[model samples]
Target chain A: MPRVDVELPSVLTGLLGVPRVVPVEASCLADALRELSELHPTIDVHLFDETGGFREHVLCFHNETNTRWLDGTDVALADGDRITIMQAVSGG
Target chain B: MGTTAVIGTAKGGFILRSDDRRTWSVEGPLFKGWKLTTTSRTPAGTYLAATASDVYGTAVHRSRDLAEWEQVETGPAWPAAAEGGGNGEARKLKQIWTFGHGGNRTYAGVDDAGLFASDDDGVSWTPVDGLNEHSTRSGWFPGAGGLCAHAVLVDPADPKRLWCGISAVGVFRSDDGGASWTPKNEGIPIVIEDKSCKDIGRCVHGMVADPKDANTIYRREHVGVFRTRDGGEHWERIEHGLPSWFGFPIVMDVPTNTLFLAPLESDEYRMPVDGRLSVYRSRDGGDSWEDASAGLPAEHAYVGVLRGAMAADQDGGVYLGTTGGQVYVSSDGADSWQTLPVTLPRVLSVEVYPS
Candidate 1:
């Protein structure tokens, strides 16, 4: 398993008190997200809908590139990579 | 030693504390950027709030002290198999509008207009199929606000007997513990006025059930204020002395047997009458009303109160917040008022727990 760092959005940490940066060991983004959910179970609902899909305002970045633009969350990952979770640009 | 209020707003939520209802201290703008939609204190003493944003969608948070909050993993949601396959045109759990607790059961009335029950004190939820899938559901629509089941009232004497208020869809009564439901809009006016489906189309802004008698229920509707003594079987207009018929946020102070409501000028503008905000109180049910905004602004206060923005604490203190982000309280049972000395984004809901 690769040890990756996940940077959470302030929108989540401000509400749930979860750390902004979480280090988890996983080989793929899918496993990393599962680990994140396991570590901070509360953030799961804020990140994904009940149907297990990303919430409307949630966006994921593998280092600098958006994970959404990648083939899928199952793509392999190496140790020391950074994953950024963010809220989409939403305002009237 | 005093009261702690959870004030929910469009931008965030605030926890206001006052040793005396006179002098106050404040906490939060917490839940920082999330739109705090509704707040509730369960009978078991858990503080709960629902938040929504264009980014992360809607989620429920629970707290013991209103300081640290936890988001519930399984809040109210429409199953992909039963309705819209995740935000479908017909059904989507847009927001949790209100929470009603009866015994160990906590019910959440939500947008997309559905009822969900939490047996373990808001930890998880299960949809109430009877009311959510009513036969006339196909005709259920939204008012100026979105389609939402915003109010749920449980009979104090009989928890099984419940009433739910859904915007643009009339009131519903469940006599068999939510196993079945029936429309109870006898004399209430309709918003969309769809004659084909007589049971729906009522835009009920807010509602309160008499603590003394579960049979009596009062609702501030789109057109006017109404009261029903026969448990929603029949209703009558209670606007005898009220300046206008339209309003939101109806609450009852059980100890004083008083009803408090904030009436806007009309549905067209949705602001105070002549830029003056007033909270009306009805002492004898809803026969007549009197202005209770003596200490509030006299004029130039063009504000509106949302449906869940007014609440009554256990000690009979009445609290209300406004679209202008002002919160007022009357310890003497709505006879007078005083501003809390703090303001924020448009106030959406206010819930107080006395210590």
Candidate 2:
């Protein structure tokens, strides 16, 4: 099993009750998110929309690569990979 | 009673505690960098703050003490974009404009124009479908402020009666506990040129209900100030004593029949009239107005006060937060003013809690 460090923005740490960075064991991006959601269930709605897709305003970067532009969340993860979730800067 | 002024701002929320109304201690930017658009207190003493981020959607946070906050997971949400609702535009909760408490329910007016209610002491919320799914919603377009349902007034006498004000769409009243709604903009002048002047296209800036009589209401609008004696069945222009017709935020002292408004130069230039900071007050129910600028800046103050950025405490203490990040307080019912010691981000809403 591969492990990755997940970084959450300040906007989410208050709701998720987790530190800015946390390490979780997973084989892929989807598995890591699932583990993150398990750790903090209330954060799912903020990350994904009703359709279970990444919310329009959310941006997930897998070490500076936009995850949405990738082929799929099933892209294999490796040990020490970093995943950062941020909201697209737009409105106030 | 100790007074606490809870202010919502572009960056977060601040709580100012005052024992003598002259000295104060401030705590906050709670919710730290998130935009706190509005703040209110439930009858049960729960403080609710409406928070939003361009990325995470809108949420409400509740606190018993002004320090610790717990975000409500079940905040307002619109139906799926594919649901064919919201007049073909995706309904998103951009801002939570106002909160009203009546009977055992708490109501929230939200941007993208919708109403929501919480029966569980601000812990959760449910959309008021009657207003969200109204038949005439298609005609309710966005104004300069965006299509925001910014005012909620729940009649104290009848828990079932309520009124909601939205930008450009005007006001709507519900007689059956929000099960249905009817437009209530009989005499409000419409300022948007794209919409029909004869219809419900009036852009209401801010509204406050008379504490003594829920039937009487005062509103500052894009065109002018207005009042309704019969709970929105009819409204009359009441901009006689003001320096300018355009303004935002209206606060009323029901005990004295006094109303306060901060008039802007014009809709195109939404700054204080003549670049001077002045708050106008009407003592006789909007018949005439008088400048209430004592202790405020005399000139070169070109800031604008937002719609939800002014509030009146139960004891008649008034406060106004301006876009330039100044908080002005008037302990003697708007007769004079004193600026708070600190400067903050753009103030969105000002609420007073007396304990």
Could you give candidate 2's per-residue lDDT for residues B250-328 as a string of tens digits? 8887677788888889988899887898889898888899999898888999988988888888677889999989999
lDDT of 1 by residue, A18-92 (tens): 899999999999999999999988777678865677876688999888887787789788999999999777558
Worst 10 residues of 2 chain B by lDDT: B82-91
| Candidate 1 residue pairs in clash (backbone atoms < 3 Å) | A57-B55
Give the DockQ (2 decimals) of all models: 0.60, 0.49
Q: Write the per-residue lDDT of candidate 2 for residues A1-92, one digit (tens) a residue.
A: 98899999877897546699979999989999999988876677678764578888899999879998998899789898999999777658
Which residue pairs in candidate 2 collide?
none
Residue A57 lDDT (model 2) = 80
By summed lDDT, which 10 consecutive residues of candidate 1 chain B come out lowest? B81-90
Per-model CA lDDT versus the true structure: 0.86, 0.84
Clashes of each: 1, 0
**Model 1: how far is B62 from its true place, Å?**
2.5
